[model samples]
Target: MSVTETVGQTPLEAASPFEMRVDLGKDVPETDVRSALKSGEIGFLHSFTTGSAVDGPGIRLVAWTTSCMFRCQYCHNPDTWTLSNGIPVPIEKAKEELRKYAPGLKAMHGGFTLSGGEPLMQSRFAVRLFAAAKEMGIHTAIETNGYYGDKLTDDELAYIDLVILDMKAFDPVQHKRVTGMDNAPVIEFCERLAHLKRPMWFRYVLVPGLTDVPEEMDRVAKFAASLGVVEKAEILPFHQMGRYKWERLGLDYKLAATTPPSNELVAEAVAIFRNAGLVAD
Candidate 1:
């Protein structure tokens, strides 16, 4: 399908190359996330965790919201893809949850990170959550795919201390193949964040035979270099750790035989970005 056709269709309606395990019977209404900001209400949440270091600098209280537009084949959190799967947590209640970790987070020089399935899907909730965290003297960050970067207003972006932007693919066709969506929005989001001078960490998953191509890696590295605000580039080695989730969800496991990239390949990919003048690992 063309990018325009895919853009207009919801995940359920799109002709995904992979077997998707979405419930067509369940009608999840499109949430007016902006209205939630005005009402000071809760948002759909998958869960939250305390003391995660890999998510951001120091320990972090990472809140994973529900719903996502992409059906990434290598996604580890397939269960988080549906809105109906998550519980609703009030904005104030979410704040209280963050408060429990605030002291610890502050002492450790850590912060709160709003994460997937896609935090931007619940933009208002994230804004409110970040605002509350800042008010409590806690730093705030977000791990986003950048597809919906425009959702957050300048005021909302002000509350975020860092942005971990996941750039899936440098090639448009490959991007659409890996994620059942176009790369235009993601690239545009990166540009928007750059224009705003947002501190960012670029993340890319290295799937051995899929995204480890030298030419594409070079393009990705060049793009990252162009983003003057990028402080770090993380080359995440893809693994089968999330394969069980796909099986549990009854979705086709396309990469069941796929292996993580070799150490040499990882180093090579890292070097591509590092050579571009960015701190890569």
Candidate 2:
């Protein structure tokens, strides 16, 4: 299938800095955004949630965007893989939504997290939203796979306060097996973040048989340690929670019978990173 066909919409055009940039406290009419949204100049989002604690530090307003390049085997939201599957909310509407939760977020030391089907797929929108959030004095974070990390400019990234990066695997072959993508871009993204001294939380999913290998875990631990800016390493135990989504979508669900890692295994994986002198849980 063609890229557009696979995504169920044309990919966003490369946006010039002038077009992507948004000013703080400026209100743009919703009617004015139709042309941009239709042209993929803005973003198509799956949905947004308020008071989500797991996406970032403290409570957060999490925006889940649509369309991803990776077909991760463990993805719970397979329906999010296509652009047409989402609600086409313009960037201004998104900012308005964030505005509702801004005061509470700040009072609680919380923030806004842009999550996805890879938020970086709509890099321009993410950058704009983050920039606006910073203007409101709200902490901003992104939950990304890092494939499109190169899309953001230094000025745009300056608006972001933290990153929650998901590093699927340390080995190239195994990484491809899990996410159907190369790890090179992800590694490059990590290196770039390190160079920027960006604070980050590293996340890894520990599937019982698929990713529980000690040697592979060690490689991940070592890489996390080398990144100096990693504030935390989260060892997420894999679960079959999303298998139903694959079944409903009529896609073959791999790892259907693969069980979640035991609590002991989770502890061991956390220990590996802790042993490497990184804070892990």
Candidate 3:
């Protein structure tokens, strides 16, 4: 399917070639990744990391895939949102690099994490990659905004050991205004994942006057509670780390002049979600 067609469509009918998994024979072993890497057959390009301290439980081999559906004003890696960006490398290459970090990751009881640009946007590739990792006995996690859950099947969900969900905003109108997308699908995705009993970490970026509002926190807390599987709800204070990227990319930095929320404001927002019974960390 065309890129435009798949951009905002429901997951069940996803037809983007970039997001679909390409089978390379059932018996292909992880050892073959080296050759695949050398030949440049990776379906979606990835930014590989040997050890990432913040992504999950332990030091992790994080694969930051390129491609996202949202256009959030405060997004850090604005370059990752477009489909045509990033260098292509074979999936094998990614696996091989991750394998090298396996021992260290294991020591931390951490394995691998698949992060953006909206890793779920390329769920097909993610599914195959995670399956291959599992075959190698690696634990897996996905850090997403829950934007593509409709396209994700139970089989796909089963492969993921953990999910870090970003709840951008609680007010649908404000959410769309900030992210250029509706909040319903993201909200519904969380509910569905919760029903599946998936382990989840819900994140909310405390965007000063934009997202740290008490009412908004209550709404998000209400929605998160409905999911029940939320292990923790995090309030991430907004920062200007990506402001330069926006300027360099020739994109308007809409939130450039906005200041981050004060520590007291962040604390208040955290308390709101905390009161809802979600472990606010």
* lDDT for each residue of candidate 2 in 34-111, tens digit (9 for 90 to 100): 444444445666667677788888888888777799988888777778755555665676788888889999999999
Better candidate number, 1 or 2, judged by TM-score: 1
lDDT of 3 by residue, 1-281 (tens): 32223222322111221232212122334444334333334434435655567777777777766668899878877777754454344456556666677777777788888887788766666777888778777889999988788877988888889899988887889899879999888878887887889999888888865676788789988788778788888888999876776777789888888898888888898888889988896
| Residues 1-281 of candidate 1: C-alpha lDDT, one tens digit per residue | 32223222433111211223333313334453345534547566666766688888998888877788998888988877886565555677788888888999999999999888898887878888899999999988999999988887887899999999888898999999899899898898888888999899999999977888888988988898898999999999999877877988889978999998899999999999999999999
Worst 10 residues of 1 by lDDT: 10-19
Candidates sorted on lDDT, descending: 1, 2, 3
For each candidate, give its TM-score against the true structure. Answer: 0.87, 0.86, 0.83
The C-alpha stretches of model 3 lying farther than 4 A from their native spots are: 1-41
Report the lDDT of model 2 for residue 47: 66
Clashes, model 2: 0
For model 1, the stretches where C-alpha displacement exceeds 4 angstroms are 1-40
lDDT of 1: 0.80
